[model samples]
Target: MFQPDIEIIAHTPNPEKVCTAAVKQTYKKMHAKELIKNTSEEEVEKLLTNIAKLGHFSTLEHACFTIAFKDVSVLFEQFLIEHRLASYSAKSRRYVDFSEAGFVIPDYFEDKPEMEEKYRKCMLYLFNSYKNLLELGIAKEDARFVLPYSFKSSIIATMNLRELIHFLYNSIYGHGKEFSEIRKVGGMLLNKMKKLCPTVLRYFDILEHKGNASILASTYESSKSEGVELLWHTPSPDKSIAIAALIKSTNLPTALLKDIKQEEMERIIQSVVRSRRPRELEQVNFTFRINNVTLAILTHITRHRIHSPLIPSLASIEKSSSYVIPKGIKENKEALKIYREAFDRCMEFYRYLKSKNVPKDILAYALQSGNFITIITTMNARELYHFFRLRTCLRAQKEVRNIANNMLYLVRNVAPLTFKNAGPSCYFYGYCTEGKMKCNRFKEVVEHYKAWHLSPTKIPGL
Candidate 1:
């Protein structure tokens, strides 16, 4: 059995004091040496309390916490690393021989003996196979392809107080509560943080809504999604709002936007967006819901830190009995049979463990890498352009490239003027960024996008 733990290995001494000093320096324009030496703890606390009360969190960035977690699974890594502003050092599956690593078991099946037996047998088989493959001279990276997400891994993560607070609030109060794993880890981190700086964390308690927790549980709990689906929300129904916002940087009067004709508005948007000035395209925000993507693909997409993603437990993937088979594998009969058999065996073990009442957390390791999961994420027009440029390239992973292509279609359908010039880097920049890795089919890619943009009712060819 694996026990997960989080230890605050290092943190700024007098964090509140440091933050308060920074606040005072910014507000009073005090000399750093003088401020650091003379600012009393009481004065710092008073200022920090006010800053929290006023919802000013940026000053907290001056203070950081470095935490180390042991016996946790890579399944939790996606959540921790999603905070792009933070720094991380985690145990890598590619380099580590996880033969000795323990596995996590969820509390739900603690009392179920039948389920426990099934789980033990399955895990034993998988681990034995992994060790055998090693003896057979298989690379750790390739052998690890069969390892489960439940395998215990360690990480030393560092985040500024601002991101820490955000992580805590979102975990305990918002969408984070939906996943039991995140809630457990969040509770542990919060307890540790409160001991370090009760004054700062107290702000969250003060801001809590009357029934926020109950509301989130009722709304988000028990939800599961499967297979590749792309959904968009809150698209600008009228392009004028985006056009006006884009021109707002020019300090133009509000009345001027109304006076501008549709054609002129179109011209302005196309010109600025096509110019590749992403800062200018930041005027509009786009939110997308992506479902049924593989866990591997989620890892790839989450690298775009500027975006926000909400993903369910990788554990829930078992219930879906779903997995993605790549095109090349599917095209060959023997290969497809072998791929399906592997997942089938994995699923059989997964269910055996469940029936025996094995801990649900440990069961996640039985999930195949190709298991499907969901992500509801958002990116502004600027980041969208960047995402499209990178992910839509031929050199990108096949799964994410498909996602990017769909995202392009969705955004273009709603805000054609804003995304008229958005696509792969080669198409957007008039040249491939991949250099020697270039697909050299830039012309064909451009023609495909052109045709897609011209159609009002046809699906784009991938």
Candidate 2:
């Protein structure tokens, strides 16, 4: 039978009543008396059911469900974690030794003995290579570059009832219906949530997809490309909108935004911004679609949960052609030879496994960490400020640093005043924070972003 090892680890007690009480508080004005005392269970159920029918689900956010996943592939974790506004604690690959770890075998390989053997054999070989790299004095972070996505992993994901319903409705009954594994897990999680808050959970529309596989295949086709491409999906048209929003917050007429020149506007924007006053920048926004980046870089940027990332399955993007050879690796002829050889062997087995009709989910085990992926996300100016400061630091990974630098350059062009202060934390605070790990190039980092702010068009090589 098709089943995934998932359990409801913890959930809010009397979740329906809690949600109903929270919903009631929002509708009525605060009268100092106790609001939730002596409410009947039947009354709570009726109230929540009525709210559900009326399509009011904001109160559902007050209820949360935490679930534990076991014996699942790392690929699944990537997909599940894309549901932002959720808390996740997954076992770390960089720190955890997966040498002796077991993997989840998909039922797709059950009827085919040859493909199943190839999968098991490939996993054993990959794990041995991974362990050998570790034995060769390579760091776990580097050695993990050889690990496959199908490697079994564990994660505890907790989400509010509102997001949980959205995840279920989207993954199980909506766009994700074509993805069998996500559909299966989504169905199981949905059933679990209904048990905790039946009244609130009852209103979700869990309809299955009628689309063909071409719809899903097209996503994978777009996932792999040869170079970095950044497109501003929803850049603000002018500085006026941002200025108007901030002025509105101050209860001032938006017409004032028109009265101020660019120079005065920059001062007004800058005056409100401080290390502690970042929340004021939330009035501005930027959305981007970045293509052809390695999963290593994707892993780092996706940590900024304030934004929503729509990603395709890692299984589809796993290909030898999609692997990125680090610049350092490419500099050494022997190292480059060895790296290419390893990827060739990995893909050779992968292609053979695919030819045998092995499921793509299982085949993802043969993919290297350098595999390519595309990510589309949106972050408000506040989160972008945080992202730039953290990811643009000298201590951060180079690939994402390039990405962060490019993002800052693009945003500055759209709203120069709003993002005038965006850059590394050291640039903003006037001192390096990395201590001994610092690149000791504080002046250089500051000048680099200074050029970005000063430039009229896109900075070359960004």
Best by TM-score: 2
Error of 1 at 186 (Å): 4.2
Give lDDT tens digits, candidate 1, residues 289-351: 787776656777786878778766544444446667665555656545555665677788767
- What does the lDDT read for residue 305 in candidate 1? 77
TM-score of 2: 0.83
Scored by lDDT, model 2 comes in at 0.70
Clashing pairs for predicted structure model 1, backbone only:
106-361, 114-356, 115-355, 115-356, 115-357, 116-356, 148-365, 149-365, 227-292
Candidate 2: lDDT of 74? 70
Cα error of candidate 2 at position 374, Å: 2.5
lDDT, candidate 2, 1-462, per-residue tens: 235688998888777777777866876665313446545688787888777777677878888889998877776777777778898897766577888877666777678787778777776766776676666555555556666766777889899888888778777656555556677788888787778777666666622233443344543654534333445534443365446546656766767555656666666677656736655567556778787777656767776799877766655654656576666556656555555666666788888977777666556666677677777878877888889888888777767777887787777777767777778988878888788878888888787767766774764222
Q: Give the range where candidate 2 is weakest over 10 consecutive residues by summed lDDT.
A: 206-215
TM-score of 1: 0.75
Q: Please give the CA lDDT of all the candidate structures.
A: 0.70, 0.70
